[model samples]
Target chain A: MITTSIESVPGRKIVEQYGIVQGSTVRAKNVGVDCVAGCQNTFGGELKGYSQLLEESRAEALDRMIQQAEQKGANAVINVRFGTSTITQGASEILAYGTAVLVQ
Target chain B: MENLIGLIFTVGLIVVAYFVGKTIENRHFEALKAREREFLDLPSLTTQHSYDEEGIQDCRLVYGNVVISGDYFKMVLAALLKFFGGRIVGYESLIDRARREAILRMQAEARQFGADAVINTRFEMSKLDAMTQNQGTGMFEILVYGTAIKVNHG
Candidate 1:
């Protein structure tokens, strides 16, 4: 299914609206990655480990959102938005949500 | 005698950290300035729609993120600022770097699709390395994302 953060798809027409579809996931890295991130923090630069973790969680959350849209028989999702919240010391939640629609 | 040595070591580390961290932050700023000039041509907006002459051919989601942490000196300075109740100048650069880098990366991704503009641009700030909000000064990630759209010239 096509997805865009903008309310309307560029060249497509929305024929039906399926309300809102959402997906969320909690993710964490291993202890080793955490330790490495701590060391990198001392130097104050990019944290590669955490970047990868965020990428993974973001993709997963989007994927689940797409699944929800598909279940609702939507061909696309629009106005998609993402949010992240730290759950604890070693885990965080990534949430993706959007309005599912049938597009032509 | 032992207390004097401890103080010396802390001071020495802070001094070294000041020099090294400033240099790194300066370099990042320079790089971001160069990129900002390039991105000016690629229109990016926070509104959900683009106001350009609308012959949009394609639209897709695009996102970029950058994670940065504090050096020894910044952490120490922030600790002092916590008591003083003022802005932490050291961390000011860190956030600036993360934000600029994130936007640039997002622009790079949009370019891959030959998109000339991005609309409904939104930013999300979060933590990295699985750190909770209560944790001490730790790594934070800045994410810039939007709907990348390619317009047809015809």
Candidate 2:
């Protein structure tokens, strides 16, 4: 499936609109990684553990959104946007939303 | 004697952190500049869409994410500056490096996909360690995403 953040695909025409499709995931870092990150903060630089964790979470959220688009019988998802918010002390939520459309 | 020892220790830690953090920051900025120049040909724009879609061959989504933390020395320096209500140069450079690195990564991805340009680029920044905003790590995450398009020349 084609997924882009613009209103229309470059070479495809939107034949039908399937409204909005969304996916979200709540993720928390494990205690072990969190502890390591806490220590790394002292030295200060890139937090590799946290970056990897967030990347995985984002991929999962995007996958879920793509699944939703497939279920809706849409061949493409456009105008995609991501949202993130801290839910608690250790957990955060990532959301992917976009308009599903049939392209030809 | 105990108070004097504690003062010495705190100062020692800050001094060590200052040297180490500055070295890392300088190295990172150099690397970012080099990679940015490498991807200079691939333009990324904030417009909603490309103006010339007729010559485009394919389009897809691309993104880059990074998380960076301020060193102990900068955290302390920023806290001190908070009292004077002035700019925190340390954290400013930290965020600047993060943003440039993120865009470079995005451009690299577009290059891998054989995309000529990226459109509708957006950035999102958030605090990763929200629980300890003041006392703990000054950490933040930067995410940049856009639609990459392959343009047909012939």
Candidate 3:
């Protein structure tokens, strides 16, 4: 599959337009990571615990997106972007989106 | 003497607990980093194309919702002991890690399709309300989508 951030793929051409293929995910934080993160203020440093939590979440979410594109038989995804919003004071969401297409 | 002994014991316990927790957290972080490295290391190339040339490809990728939940009661207690602070710091790092992982996965997928570049990528996040209310359990959905193009920069 050929994926890019731009609208068009260079060198090769997009033979078929596969409409709009997308992947989305909603991840919630566990209580343990939150509690450790809450205390990070006093200790000050890297919250390795929460860092790992987010990493896992992001991976899982992207995996779903890729699966969706694959289902459509897309050769690539392009124009990938990410957005994050705080659902609450202690919680937030990260989304990744892009275009799925087949190029030759 | 009794007061001194009690204080010493309490301090010792706290110290031991802190070390143990740190060790566990470090291990988890290491594992995550390894996974991230593997994803990013995948062979992939990036390219850009113009709309006039190929028209609107309109490609999208939707990932299954992955929910990861954990409780940091000890950390919360520690934060409470010191006062409600450092939440932002924790959040910043957490978000950063999450974004990186999402990007890596997208890149890997792009590579699989032989795409040199990805364009117009976007991300979305939401909270899992049904899961937890008080502890702030939320879901972060990363949707990395864009136009996969093969461009000739020559």
Q: For all the predictions, what are the DockQ values?
A: 0.61, 0.68, 0.13
* After superposition, candidate 3 runs with Cα above 4 Å error: A88-91, B1-154
After superposition, which runs of candidate 1 have C-alpha atoms over 4 Å from their true positions? B52-54, B128-134
Give a tens-digit lDDT track for model 2, residues A15-52.
99999999899998787777787777877888888888
Best TM-score goes to which candidate? 2
Share of real contacts kept by model 3? 0.12
DockQ order of candidates, best first? Answer: 2, 1, 3
Per-residue CA lDDT of model 1 for B1-154, tens digit only, reads 9999999998997788778878888888888999889989787799864455358888889999887888888888888889979888788878888888998988988989899798889989976645633254567888899988887875
Query: Which portions of model 2 show Cα errors greater than 4 Å?
Result: B131-135
Work out the iRMS of candidate 2. 2.0
Of the two candidates 1 and 2, the one with more favorable lDDT, higher being better, is 2
Fnat per candidate: 0.69, 0.71, 0.12
Mind giving the per-residue lDDT tens digits that candidate 3 earns over B1-154? 9999998886765666556545654664676688766655332223233333544333433221222222243444546755755554434444454555556666666666565445555555544333334443223433334444334333
Q: In angstroms, how far off is A20's CA in candidate 2? A: 1.1
Model 1, span A1-104: residue lDDT tens: 88898778777778999999999999876787778876666667787887888888888999999999999999999989899887877788889999999998
Over B7-86, each residue of candidate 2 has an lDDT whose tens digit, in order, gives 99989988988998888888988888888888878999999654588888888999998888988899889888999997
Error of 1 at A1 (Å): 1.8
Candidate 3's displacement at residue A41, Å, is 2.1
